[model samples]
Target: MKAILPGSAADTDKPVVLGEAAEPEPAADEAVVAVEAYSVNRGETFQLDGGLERRWAGWRPGKDVAGTVIRAAADGTGPAAGTRVVAHPPAYGWAERVAVPTASLAELPDSLDAVTAAALPLAGITALRLLRAAGPLAGRRVLLTGASGGVGHYLTELAAASGAEITAVTATAERGARLLPLGAVELITSVDEAQGPYDVVFESVGGASLPAALAQLASGGQLVWFGQASREPVALNFFDFFKGPNQARITHFDYTTSDTTYGQDLTALVRLVAAGRLHPEIGSVRDWSRTADIITDLRGRNIRGNAVLTVG
Candidate 1:
């Protein structure tokens, strides 16, 4: 087996060095996947920067994976060997092969390829949970900030399918145009000029945009804060909460939880992909050996959609 190793936070140049390692065998409750493809998330950069901490506390940098089960636990409660599946691995997913608990794996529909399936887990789950927290999306005037990235694209599609009228905010005209076919009812390049008073505001970009998003929400509306793309601190006014005639709700999303919800989310995503409701827009696909360059491209925000590394 081959894997990428990161020594420390300061060593940014090609942090993922390919090296041969022994193939992992599944534990009693684990399964070994022959990784076919994996998607990169923005948080991977934070992990590289030593900003985001990992559950396993090691520095291998891949998270969402779709692949075939090469070996399963003896109990057979997991996917059978040779079954195609996607999983939210315990650690971030940067590897040629991974050993994960069977609970993390979700069966992929025949219509969804490993590459696209790889794009679903983290981003898809976050979108589902965000929309659920926002309540029934039907007929709601929804505002999506930073609606051009991985999670943003999925959020847009999911919200649209639920019959929400979506207004998407992007940083550039080019990115804004990309959202037109993705079900964005309106595109606003400048947040300041955005006509809102939306029923729900999905805030993926934080910092100045957080307060801006909150301002756009209609009284009694809800705001779901998911990411901090700007990486800036957000300021809020306490008096605004009580002074407003209508009630307002603010919620933050965290996807780190039990494997059951993770599996359910991926399964729903696979079904959406099969039904032509969710199509993952991939910005770039690179060979496994070019992991460092992929991370650099992602960090620069030069890539759009979810970036996948084809391991095969």
Candidate 2:
């Protein structure tokens, strides 16, 4: 079996390699999936490029995968053999096959292709959960910072459907262009340009962006901080809160820590895609052999949305 793994720490350009791996062994509550396609996420690029340190020597770098069940769980808890599915494995998903827990697996409809299904797990689930955190979007003003990635694409469409007015912040107008049709009322390059008094703020690009978003928070608004793509420390003064409406709050988010089950949320997203209600923006699709190149593109921000790689 072959899987994409982190290369030598000194290798800056090629940070990952399609190397040999042990065949998957499913637990009683897990199924063996024959991976058809997998998507690379922005966070995985950090782990691969050494931007985020690996806690162990042999850490693997994949999370979102779509495939067919090759073996059902011994306990019969998940899809049977030959079922098409999208899954979020605990880890080690960048392989020909992976062992996925039943709780993280969702049967895919025949209408949904593997490439699109592969794009859904991590980013889609995160966006879904973020929207859940925002709660009751109808008639609310929502501000989304760093609104051009996979999560952003999903979040924009999801929030807009809930009747929330969205102001998306991107690094450039061209980078933010696609978000317009997805339901963003306006796009701004900097968070500082956002109109204040938003009911909910989805903040991902941290740094000065954090405080800038806080300044726009409305009375009792909720600002969810998810990622720090800027990789800079956020310095906040006590008076920064006074710039916004009183009692505004900021909540840090981690999708893994969310109460929702992966299978449950993934199924909701898959159903939307099947019904033409949700669209997964696939920026790059290529053979899995080019996985390293895709990772490089993601790190460079050259690839928009999710990047999917097909397995032979």
What C-alpha lDDT values do all the predictions have? 0.81, 0.90
Q: Please give, for residues 1-312, the per-residue lDDT of candidate 1 as tens digits.
A: 687776557877765677766666667888888899998888877777677775464447767998999888776778889899999886646677888777777998787888889888888888888877788989989999988888889989888989999999888878667677888899887668778788998887888888877877788898888888877888877786566526877887776743346777778888888988888888888887887888888777788788898986
Cα-based TM-score, every candidate? 0.93, 0.97
Q: Look at candidate 2 and tell me the lDDT of residue 144.
A: 95
Give stretches of model 1 more than 4 Å off.
240-245, 257-260
Candidate 1, position 70, lDDT = 85
Top-scoring candidate (lDDT): 2
Candidate 1: give its CA RMSD in angstroms. 2.0
Weakest 10 consecutive residues of candidate 2 by summed lDDT: 49-58
**What TM-score would you give candidate 1 relative to the actual structure?**
0.93
